[model samples]
Target: MSVHRVYLPDLGHGDFEPGAVLEITGQEARHAVRVKRLMPGDVLEILNGQGLRAVAVLGESRKHPAGHGKTEWAVDVRIESVAQEPPISPRLHVLACAPKLTRVEDMVDQLSQVGAAAWFPLVTRHTLTPPKAERVDKLERVAAEAAKQCGRAWTMEIGSPVPLADALSRTHRAIRPSARLVIADPRGAPYSPDGSTDLALLIGPEAGFTDDEVDAACRAGAMLCSIGPHLMRVGTAAVVASGLILNAEQPR
Candidate 1:
């Protein structure tokens, strides 16, 4: 059976050599002990979401009383091994317009699972509801949980909402000067991999992008492409586009 996984954002803080003992506290510890019922000798995988992964054997759990009459849980785990997973190739960054309600949360989870390097909420002309700070926080949490479940060493980054122009400019900066820009639209040609290691995909809102927005994107060097035969909601389109781009066969 695959070992259960937990996220430890501070896994890089200290030495993690074999046989090292690390105490897991806070929300993660509580979840492992209370919810997972992890016991002594149980093996688990811990990820730091920055390419660091550790295999550890569970030790004992301890509880401490708080002043407010609540108890906090902590668990000790003995490190068995540590490894750094390399980032996936053809890094995909998704910039999708915010969908209505909680669908954006689901999109983050799915994108993280599918190996998207990051997600940004695109504030397009047709976008009606941009994500708030609280929603962004929740999206981060969702990404973390999805990373643990999917066994990805690194978590998908959640970027703040940005306007279309800003989004284009940010991706064109020195960091990813070679990043391919793609916009999903019905009028574009079929999607294909161009073998660019870095790619930014834009998915418009339900009402779709305005002509001016499409013109701006094309002017910014974004390729207009169709992801599927039928129209899809914001979340679905993002996932489908990401999958196609991430899994496509690149030129040898």
Candidate 2:
């Protein structure tokens, strides 16, 4: 059976020894107790949202009063073992202009599943919608859930919405200096996965980027690359490009 995984934001907060007991509360507790129906002695896995993972066994379940006039369930688990997972190599960072909140959420989820190191939501001239802080929270939640589903210990970082110019200037920090900065454009070099470790992909809005924006990114040391001849939506382009890069990076 597939080991059920739960995200514990505080998993690495305290020192853990063998047989150490840890308490899990709130929605995560509900998922473990009510949804999974986990009982004492049930083996499960826990992630710290970093790279720390632990093998834990459920110890007990309890009902407690929540602040908002409701009862909530909490669970206790005993840590059996812990391990640190190494980060993905040649980190992949995707810089995608916001399409819409809903679409952006899906993009974040997909990228997280594909082991993207980070995601940047760019507000470009052709962007139809502006991303908000609330949506950033939603996107993070989606990424966390995707990480759990995909059996990844680390979650992708979602950056706050920023203008295209700001996003271009900050690209250097997102990846290594030697990493490739690929801007998705039709009139550019054809993409060929070179198994490079550091790659930052910049996906434009559905309406496409303006000439000045393209020139600015190129000046910032971005290489315009084409994913395909056909036009693709922002999310679709991200998924396809990320998949290709990841596939090429895989060990042969």
Candidate 3:
């Protein structure tokens, strides 16, 4: 089995186990303190989201007088035990567009679910939503949660948003002599990679790519690949292409 695959929070310190006291913090803490109605002595599973599976018993709830309406806090009462994790494989990066609102969130959530190496949100001419750093932060949180839940060995890296041209350049630099680059062009012919050293798969936006964008991407080192008969949404194409890339690289 793979090691406790949870991103961030370190999950260090503490001898985690049954009867151990732990405080839920941040949005997670808020959910537990406010929404869950968890009171003092409430025993719950305190997964560092890393699969430690430490059973945590909540002590008394305390409020801070230092700050105004200071949020609630929890303290772990006891320590149960701890466990180490196994190793996983190297990651594969997923470079894609910000598909606006629900679509973007869904993509972020799903990509992390699938164990992507990293996420690069590109700003193409067809990009309608200008994603703010705050929005990307939300994406990061979502990925972290997904990683914890899905037991991913490493957290997916959320990269800064760059221009499509810049993304093309990055792809060229990322590819090895033996590695291949494939871009999803609905009208392009089907051609898969030769061998997997590492891949930087590109997925375009809803309106797809302009002729200039396609030409630039091709020049930058991406192989034009088709999705067969029908056209797919940028989001759908991303998920599908990601699956294809990972599956193709996997040992048969």
Candidate 4:
């Protein structure tokens, strides 16, 4: 099994110092101590999941380093060091229809694995999945779990599920002019791939965008684009678009 990268907010104080005892509690402790069966001297990396990481050592109990036949585990972890990484480049944000339950969860997981800056759930005309307010927490958990599995230094940010029209209006107001917007149409014209520094990719449901939806997106400055000859699943299309966006952004 791989050494899990656990994300805990209070890994250390203001200036992260190496070798400071980090206290792990709740689910994290259960995972590392009970489930993981991690013994003293085992090493794991601790991430605040906001771009900071530290190496930590496991210890058994408050009175650690016990000899003889006693085995109560404690996270007597000392952060080796905290190295902050640069933020994700050319932020690739995704806007997609809210798919069904299992599908949406999988999409969120896949989106995090593909390094999207944020996932915005969209409700379109043909969107069959009713946006569940309570599911936001479920989505967040999926994102965090997926990020952990993928070694991402940041938890995937999930925006509230909004109507497609409202989402477009908000996008126009929220993003800068240079932020390229691309809509996946399967029938759209090919766009120049060079203008993707901070991109927003919009994907419709399996039913594709309605005529009105297309027109609205166009009015809102979204360029129509295609992902080549084959039709792809909503989740697959999002991944492909994110990859294309990441590749198109110019190297700084």
lDDT for each candidate structure: 0.86, 0.82, 0.65, 0.75
Candidate 2 per-residue C-alpha lDDT over 172-238 given as tens digits, one digit per residue, 9 for 90 to 100 = 4655567777888989887777778888888889888999999998998887877887999999899
Worst 10 residues of 4 by lDDT: 167-176
- True-structure lDDT of candidate 3: 0.65
Which ten residues in a row are the worst by lDDT in model 3? 1-10
Predicted structure with the largest lDDT when compared to the true one = 1
Q: What is the TM-score of each candidate against the true structure?
A: 0.92, 0.88, 0.69, 0.85
> RMSD to the native, candidate 4?
4.4
lDDT for 62 in candidate 2 is 94
lDDT of 2: 0.82
Clashes of each: 0, 1, 10, 3
Which ranking of candidates, highest TM-score first?
Answer: 1, 2, 4, 3
Rank all candidate structures by their lDDT, best first, as comma-separated numbers: 1, 2, 4, 3
**Model 1 accuracy (lDDT, Cα):** 0.86
Model 1, 55-117: lDDT tens digits are 999999999775699989989999999998878787888889888887888899999999999
Model 2, residue 15: displacement in angstroms? 3.8
**lDDT of candidate 4 over 34-76, digit per residue (tens):** 7877778888877766877667777764423346865444466
**Higher-lDDT candidate among 3 and 4?**
4
lDDT of 1 at 141: 94
